[model samples]
Target: MSQGQHWREQLHEAAAQGDTASLLKVIRSAVAERADVGDYTLMSRLLKRIGRDEASRAGLRPVRVYIARSVTVESWLPYLAVEAAAAGFWLETKVGGYGSFAQELMSPEGALRDFNPDLVVFVTDVEDVAGGLPDACATGKPELVRAEVERGVKTMEDMLTAFRHHHRARLLVQGLCVPDPPVLGDAGDANWEASESRATQRINEQIAALCRRLGDAAFFDENRLASRFGKARWRDERMFRYCRLSIAAEFFAPYARALTHSIKVLFLPPHKVLCTDLDNTLWGGIVGEDKPSGILTGTDFPGNCYRTYQRYLKQLAARGILLAVVSKNNEKDVREAFRVRAQDLALTLDDFISLKISWQDKAVSLRELAQELSLGLDSFVLIDDDSVECEAVRQQVPGVLVIQAPREEPWRLTECVMASGAFDTLSVTAEDRARSDEYRAQAQRAQLENRAASREEFLASLQIVCRFISALEAPLSRTVQLINKTNQFNLTTRRYGTSEVESFAADPGGLALALRARDRFGDAGVIGIALCRTQDGTCTIDTLLLSCRVIGRGIESALLWYIARWAASLGANRLAGEYIPTAKNQPCADFYPRHGFRPAREAGGKQSRICYVLDLATQMPEKPAWIQTEEDLNNEPGPSCARVNEEFAR
Candidate 1:
């Protein structure tokens, strides 16, 4: 066999034997020879054989890539990359050491320009800042390290700018992983970790700031992951494990893959709604029999935990996850708990999209809730403290994700859920932070409409403003979010990735617009999004979705009006859209007809598509004064208005 084949066989054998030293030798040898042995693809295939394809597809596989030349990089990069890749990601494997920050930053841009990639993964070692190693061993001295780190930061910023300017590639910045201070003899001495942790923290902070400024990049916390595994394990084992030959080459493979998988999942959007149980789940006891004061929420050790869990849920609600109650309890008791005793409760009934408190099977209740919220069962997560309840829902509802509550240690419930990492995302937008308040306002609007006697009167009283703007060079995070989470008001129900949205906007034929609404009750944040493309002077709506909280207020009509007007301004003669229904989007089945668009075609099943068109040149109805003009819309900073205050009061 040729030398390349010989090394490949050696690697395969080392991987099979789980020999760490042999594996490292093979990897190092491959790197030394610059042998394009396709190790990443080989490892990914092997992982897929074990039914662990999630990580492989994410591109976290073993391959050498140029990392900064420092004692920390020399010590940690190989293992970190292997673990991260095995966790999933096809890593670039070009091993060359950089002596300075400017070199490190500029090198990648040249490499990227030569070899175009969809994503770039950058890792920095915390040791550069933490400072225990001698000056000769580290990349730069204490005083000089700041400039080096800044250069690295600027390099990333420049690279992202280039990516946006050229290929529009996505960037994932991995935080520096630190050695356990205790294990490294730096623990408890405040100063030991102070300089190091602070340095690493500063680098991460810079990285995050860059991500926000760039608008498309994401920051991943490698230190957080390393911390979770403990400093002792990272120092004593991880640092040296990948360097030893006798250890199984593939022993850390799973861990690497898991890390990559976790990062990829973090980038994926999260579920929009949470379906939770009441008794012993949200609180410590049954509300039906126990007096509001009798419930064990918000007091001692265990109660504190339950309260902490509720607070976390409230935080989640604030991030725009529609909270709904699915419980088997007395309706009056539940009502009193939130109304009278819930001043201390982390969440209230007003926060939920739907509340079903009856003896009905939870699976059935969930179905009803989905219908009410205009969401799919797949988009909902079911949380209950009872194992039987969790299992029953899982068995009955195939798509419903069931999360069991902490039965024995009720206080640990919050930690358990958080640990599951169900809600982690690459970034959170301003719209997300105000989600709970928006839902609360939505509930009040519903109540008012029910009593108003006429839809027109209720809408008129709303004094709602619907603003539309042509897509700019702004971030697509909010647009991507609405596409993923919205159901009831989603006309086409098509979800797009960040990259896809960017591509759509760049296309001359395509169109993207954001819709914001506010009323006397409160500002609803950015509640609606629509993306379309023009063909033969006809504008076709590729995506149309709005948050449920802002529905029933004539905002939909206002939005359509804006689209029609925009199409006319663009000199398009016709406006086209589709109605593809999901289980939760039945509410919008008749939406097009109501908006003066007629179906030109139809198909079958959930996959069925419908096409509609309207002549933009034809005079449309007078734009509602309540709808804010596009220019006026840009003046408002965020969703802050009396509408939110009124909703909170209600």
Candidate 2:
């Protein structure tokens, strides 16, 4: 037998034996051979058999998802689960029967409740919501159209209310897909006043607004996907009418990818940095050999391709992904190009926070970049046009993601990167947009530390300020962002959504504080969060987390000190905290005890949980002299405080 056939046999054996290593080897071999990997059915089967093997292997836990659709979806869910793996998520998928979403979710003892999903997706279409389109020809009045749309939207809202009351799953309602040939034909949207088309559009808009109002719900746009994929090609009349399947089998691949991408972004954190090659990757020619002017760039020929690609990278940087340059070139030449003739270039030297222009290997330079930025290897995306560089980073740095640029049509580079779906996010907090500035400030802080005579002098000279404010009175989105992204400095490592954070703040005697920090270097937006519940004049710390970027600067200790003082003012005499260890949070294992909190309880055997208690009345902890602290009451309250919780007056 040929080598390809032998590899296939080995794959089958590995699948049978449930060997993840062997399965990965087969997939890698297929890529090396430049052969088709087929429909990935064998890989899907292997993944299902391994359950959460990918999560353990990839250093990420699987997201338990329960999908409820108006049509049959079991056949396509496996494909979506595989796609989610690319985003570092292993989806533990469970699907409900056709047209059973409302019944299952609303019922007290239903399959949805038993599954206890982390995320619940309701894949519905126009047919499910619209009881056939309103007769546009019957009445040209806009009032009739508005009334019909409201009726359809009300049904969805009712179902959403039931789901919210029943379970704490993040609800993702699939938007309506434009019907094949659009039942009303070309005239469906004629004169830009088609009642049927207008009603469906209104329904989607209301659903999006409802998600914002609820703070936990999100709407995925299936209508745009169906239109882009060609409504005619997306619909299978026989399957739709007989089998009641709205999405055709052939279109399931992209559809599954879109769904999986949406779900992944909700849980999987996006990359923090983008490292690119300065030579052909960023421009059309090598700057080392091709003189700055001679290099193909600007608004001409192949140069335009590089310009377009550079523009996209700049856009990514603008939204707060740090940019760095790692190239095998002389630093003088690269600097000269960006300095003297920067008007011709879309990217400038200021765009990159770090620049390593040397003859070192790409992997080595990438590691240096990560160290300088104080970010993990898993949080970097290395983009190079050279296949050798890409492969080297993939082999040497296991966690770093490698994106190879398209050499044939350089303009296609942006499309290639975007298609990876790596940078997609549902929300962009203030902290996210300021990440580039934050890292730049960190570099300055390091320089200052080196010049200081002592650590205390360094911190005092830097003049760090901490603002403690209730989450309800602070930026809710930024607080949620820090709570979810922070790992090492997180005590409990429990993630909460916006709505859940609101719920915690709204509960009686529950307190949630978001801490913002600023130093002489720059502002670190909403770097910490503290959630506690008080009962019988005793407060229990539910979660106290700080961003890794702000740690080691005595911020953690200062935060806890302020928490004790705040609790005392609220009439709480006792404070409690717990340390729950995890693979990534080992740095915080002794956090509670180190801060003078005595052990209260311990359990969970191997996964030991240790609790600590502090008497707030007896212990009057002072904020560090080096750090200035204050309660922020100037900003307006967030939506979280608008609930039935007791509002505080200034």
Candidate 3:
């Protein structure tokens, strides 16, 4: 029997025997396997019936997804759930009534609002926009096309506004795809007015712009997705005739794969660092054997593809994914290779945050890189051309996602890495664009620290600056991102949706603070969020989270000091804090105690949750003198960077 057949039989047997352990193992193996759509459908149904809750218990982040669609997506729901499961999310999906999304979104007693999804997906079918086109409207007329565009965008704006009126769930709006045939057929490719494809593409662009204005919304390019999967194959006339299915049954799995790629970002942050192999993975040949002169990485046949691959990596670096080298090669030789080929190279040696070029196991090198960067093993994604090396790293350091780059077929390497979805994110902020530079500065700071005589001297020499922005003044995107992503050094790993974070900012009783830290090296953008509420002359810190990158720095201390002073200003007699124990939050288990708060006893003397309270008048955490702290505060400022009140900055 074939290997896949054998695996499927084993999986079936495990499920039939009701062996939970065996079933979980099989499911893990199956999710990673290249299974057919039919088999995947079966596995998904079984998982839904038996394994979803168990999987959540095992550690899958539970996400509620509501699909607001006018087409038949019920058949596609299993695919969506299965793909989400694979991407470490247990999705409970709710589909709106067929062809009734307008009513569903507008109604006061809407099911879409009732489901309370973490993400609301608007899976746009072409009929959504094109159905409004006038019967006699010529594709050659820009006015006709423009009217439809306005109508479509206006309709979407109205629905979106209504949806946001009740829900703060992040939106994933699917871009509308062109129908099977072009509107003008032979003349379709002439201009924007000449083709339905052009019209849809224009509408998609407008939709993306609208989503960008909405802040928490993302546009999934169904146009590109359909093109990639072949629109010819995705369509089924019989299925559409029987039911309102636009996407074929077989294509639902791919559709789900695409959906999950976007949805995954809503729950989990992308891999922070990319560990790359130097030799054949980055170039077209082994550097040790080929030498610097002979390395195929210039403007040539195979070399051009390798060069294209490097460009892709550079683009990813630009978008905040740190790149590192974990190759079994001589460091000098690699440096020489880049130096010799500087004119044609897309990447420089300085692009890499950590270079583990000694003859060490890639897994060991990755661990060292993790330690050096002060990041967890799970934050890495490694790509190598050797399958053996990839498998070895997978076996040894399973936390690191490993991608096997196509060895001979260099052209496919970029797409393969892109398809891995390890570095997926909905949007990139200014901080994201500066991430690589910030990490490089971090490396410089590490060097400076190694040379410092004492901790005090090191801290003093760093010249760290801590700037506080009030919840009202702070950018909600970064604040919400920090709140959801930071696990370690978090008093309570309380993840909040964007809407809740916005509500915290809007509420008068709540005091939410975001801190931006910068040392002599560079700016580490808003790295901490403290969500607090005041009641009965007491200020309770509901959530205090510091990004792992800036946790050990004195910024957290400075932030606590500001919070205490803010509370005191508000006439809060006591400052309250609580530590909720989580597997990953051991680093912050004693955070309150370290800050001079006394642990308070609960009615049942519950050991799971430890509460602390400090008299604001008597006890205040010492703000680090070495760091210069500033605050724009709660006072409204003009449309500029000018601080409204530096009085709180002392």
For residues 443-487, write the lDDT of model 3, one tens digit per residue. 888899899999889989999999988754457777777777777
Cα lDDT tens digits, model 1, 1-650, are 77667767877887788554455445544533444325544533443333323333332333223433333333333444544432223355343343353344444356544545445455545443334422311433456546555654655567546554554445556666644453324443235433445555676788788776665467776677556655445444543445422112332332343345445543445666787888898888888778777777765766677778888887887677778888988898888888776766777776677788999999999888766554567667878998888879977986676778877778777776665455667667887676656666766877997899777777777777665654342236677667766767888877555667766666766667677777777876677877877667888888887887666656777777666655555557888878886667877888888777767755454566777776656646345544544432232223322322332354
Give the whole-model CA lDDT for all candidates, comma-separated. Answer: 0.61, 0.76, 0.78
Report clash pairs, candidate 3: 139-193
Worst 10 residues of 3 by lDDT: 636-645
Task: Name the candidate that leads on lDDT.
Answer: 3
Error of 1 at 143 (Å): 1.8
Candidate numbers, best lDDT first, in rank order: 3, 2, 1
**501-601: candidate 2 lDDT, tens digit per residue:** 87777787677888889998888978888888777877889999988888888888888876665566556889888888876787778887777778986
lDDT of 1: 0.61
Query: Local error of candidate 2 at 303, Å?
Result: 1.2
Q: Which residue runs of candidate 2 sit more than 4 Å off their true CA positions?
A: 1-10, 21-38, 53-60, 107-109, 134-142, 187-190, 536-538, 569-574, 599-601, 615-620, 633-650
For each candidate, what TM-score against the reference? 0.68, 0.90, 0.92
* Candidate achieving higher TM-score, 1 or 3: 3
